[model samples]
Target: MSGDIQPDSHANGHLNGSSERPAPLTVAGVAQRLGVAASTLRTWDRRYGLGPSAHVAGSHRKYSPDDVARLERMRELTLQGVAPADAARAAVAFDPAHPEASPAPSQLVRERAPVERLLVDPLSLAAAAVEPDPRRVKRMVEQEVEDRGVVRAWTGVAGPALEMLAQREKTDLPGVEPESVLRAAFLTAVRDAAVRDDAAHRRADLVLLCADESQRLQAHVVGGGLAEVGVQARVLRAEVVQDPSQVLDVVDRRRAGVLAVFGAVPGAEDLVTAASERGDVAIFLVGDAAPSLWLPHVHRVRTLSAAVEEMAAAISTHV
Candidate 1:
């Protein structure tokens, strides 16, 4: 093999910004570097005998940097449909995963699920509900309802988890996004709960302001549910201006006393803080913006139904 050096190159590196090659890596370090659970590496060893090595002195099980490099090469071949055993042999025989050394995506995947695996854990039945098809997601939600009680289905299975998955579904992770459909499903669960006469009968004049069209769309699905609960809303899509004068202006001009959807702009807290100055209006937020981030000022709601519930709570005195 031509002696070349680069970081994470299964082969000698000429591409990565390195001059001299570094020494081989250890098994534990490889597992960390590859971002996988160590158990997976142990399994790969038993199944494929990959990166086999003995102890340095105490006969401790270990893998060398070169072994990690070889395994990485094998991962690439396997990704391209080659058998893992064949790939392992090819890598050791000077066929590596990279032309110049760099941490390959395949190596990362081989070690563990991607960094965003929590969002797509198949066992996380709740996470699977983010599909665009409302019917499919609702069906699952109904199933959850049957399995668990109404409140448990919402707070335990569907609450904070949906909030997190919504963030990741937009990320670059490759997986099925079943959020909207799931949201629809969970909404069905909450709405199915026996509607009690809301103690307070206050009218909620709600206004939704979002940064752009896409954010606006997310807000509407939420806003539509509120309308069902008798909280009338006028949805407005606006560019994320630095000042809240425009937001306040719309709220004032439209005579909307409640602002529940404020997520289009990332700096929603600032807007909520600004709205707080208006004191007469009640502000609520749903999304990554922490409820504790700006308490009392803005009620934090993760899902559409929660937003509606928040709206109901705020005007409880009148409702």
Candidate 2:
């Protein structure tokens, strides 16, 4: 009976008569198997220490079977709403040889005891700047967005994080390069929140555009925030509309109820003037730019939150 080879009915692959193991998996292979982005795996490795254990000389690091299993547990826990830090701790301690010996997901959840903490507070930015962890910053922003809505997440977390990064950039501190990563994370979170509605339901009630080609990020933030409140807004990136005249065509073609011009770039006054001349669509001017004349159709808002509130009000009136 000991020598007899019984084919495993449950296992995908049969082991040889001898107790041999498969080769270590590459990062790509592990990412594919776990259904996570390769970059995500690297981030977990770099930030959480959930990386490959086997490293050969002059060759890429390879993930052992146990390493992959631990990461898989981490991914599972995170998807189940576990905090990244707690999940990473659990994963690192998990024994792959005896999975049953590891703490159950529910036990892990109970042990961690979920607390509804405001991950991003205005005052917290100061501490975040003092001890910056880019991974933690990205995760907190994303988690806040999921827990709170896009507006709260932006105002409370992402916006402050970006402002801090910008401030740091202005200083003479070297090796502080968090702008690109933080921006990418914030954009991805906002965009994902924006596109949750069905395509047919995304009809344009308001068209959000940058004043010129330089305020695209502001345009997107406004658009995403508007989208969160069920206000369908067509966001025109700066690259798409080079001239103010091009905006007229978009407003005409879309029959947009409102036109929101963000920031005061070059030719913003002309754009506002042209839109006002139409006298058909309500125009919202955002930022510090003062209107040349107080036109009945044009309204100026000081902040993105105010812009969203104005757009929502406009939509309610039209509906």
Candidate 3:
């Protein structure tokens, strides 16, 4: 709104020789414009000084056209495999008068080397998840599954990316939105990859449950992987059931031969004990912090394939 530094109106939609100044954009608006998460914009602003120049003291920051252009340049550079810090420097030095004068080819190559690993790597998946770009994340995740199968895709792509997000949550922002977005995309992809056994006489042989909602993806991936090998695994959510004992009831009703639990569920020993007592059932404790339960037929597994293979073997033996 200041007379000394009005951004180009054309950049913000004013055109056809119009002289009107464009409306200022809030952080959310700019985030929407750039197809990135609001958290990402805040991170850039805090670390790279790419915040709105129109920001006034004691007022909510709003991006001017020039600010948006700089961010656009920053995004472009980063997407081209340029490191964020390097891209920020280039973005800050962007000359609005010559917007086409982007970072030189030589500069791009020099800056891109360090970040090239992001292209089709777990780093890229994590970055996409942080950005919370559902469509892109969904495609990339499913592609990993299609190319590497459920087990590899979960271990090499989705799992690592999710773990990265979880770690970042502890060190960075205190919100679950980014993780939730990635999980949604991951579950969609894994669920779609499932090769369900639809035969009327084919009953589910295994019942899968996560320790909590956070481990839902692991359970789903295991279920999907089991389905691929012609094993029927029923995925049950402990959170969805009113009581933990109800999970056991479902298992009994389904006549599930294998009970595989992912992650460390608090006070799950009772359920594990009950399941273990079912002489006909095989119990599996999965993940790094698998519960140390004093029960029989308890198989501890740490990897997706191990869990699937063990459950499949149990089912085959039971049959």
Candidate 4:
């Protein structure tokens, strides 16, 4: 990593001149280093006053090492269950210039006592969902995704909690609005996992679409799972596409190598028929609601994990 950092000629004076300070990084460079979006960094700056400290005339803003460190701390804290506003405040207050003044990563983990308690057992998460503490539930779900891969995290924690919520809804339980909380948290995790930095994989066209308008969650699961293996997918919600032609347009535009349609919503058969007509792209049918009558050239799978494996295999063979 040290070798990757080269001193800027402008910062370091001429051959005979004394060496100057190291060059700060641009927004893109810092974003790549931190594994976050450049827009996210901009948002932090605008909202939390965490912008670059060093500014050169007639040039773009550049972040010093200290600024990077502070932002890194903020990201770490936010991911570990700290509220963004609170995390930003703490990060801004931290003295990144003084290494000893900053708390260790382990200390940060220890600070999240409430969230830690919720993650102590699977039963605790389910119990928390009964009362529906949205913040706690979101944090637990995020932590699970970080610890386990997307597939395992969804299947083991988020999926079961959601199932419990469905059961509670059937009984008309009070204070249970799990849908909004779960959807937001799950989408956030999916965005975080779906990093498209690899040039080779970026061109590999893989699309995951929901067959039914209400069955959007399964598409997210498949997208997240595909992301774990470094495959980026274009996720199309069911409502976004009106008919088979629209789905075909997306596939053609993306030059999709593999297309996985999830859910058992109405008109799925028509969509499958249209996709099957395209001989080049491998089509897959996934989820419990998948069509009972399997058509030629359509690969069917029951679970998200299986869909992920099938997608990976198709990409490997076809792309």
The top-ranked prediction according to TM-score is: 4
* Segments in model 1 whose C-alpha atoms lie over 4 Å from true places: 1-135, 142-204, 207-229, 233-243, 261-264, 285-310, 316-319
* Cα RMSDs, all models: 20.2, 16.1, 20.0, 10.4
* Model 4 regions more than 4 Å off: 1-122, 169-176, 196-201
The 0-to-1 C-alpha lDDT of every candidate, in the order given, reads: 0.53, 0.68, 0.70, 0.68
TM-scores, all candidates, are 0.35, 0.55, 0.56, 0.59
lDDT by residue (27-105, candidate 4, tens digit) is 7888998899865785576446676777776454578767887888788888998777678877776775454575544
TM-score of 3: 0.56
Q: What C-alpha lDDT, on a 0 to 100 scale, does residue 212 get in candidate 4? A: 65
Worst 10 residues of 1 by lDDT: 193-202
Error of 2 at 122 (Å): 5.6
User: Candidate 2, TM-score vs. the true structure?
Assistant: 0.55
What digit string (tens of lDDT, one per residue) describes model 2 on residues 144-209?
766555666777776776676566535534775566556666778777767763132354455555
lDDT for each residue of candidate 3 in 109-178, tens digit (9 for 90 to 100):
3423431112456778888877657777877877776556677788887778877877774443456476
Better of 1 and 2 by TM-score: 2
Summarize candidate 1's per-residue lDDT along 1-319 as a digit string, tens digits: 3576435434333245554544455556777876665545643553345644534543234565456666666666777986455565566553344445544334533443432212222236544554344554566556655444344455556555566666673743355556655666665554443222111112434445353444454455444444433344556656533456777787777666667654456456677777887677777766664334564556666765566667645543321
Candidate 1 vs 4: which has more lDDT? 4
The TM-score that candidate 1 achieves is 0.35
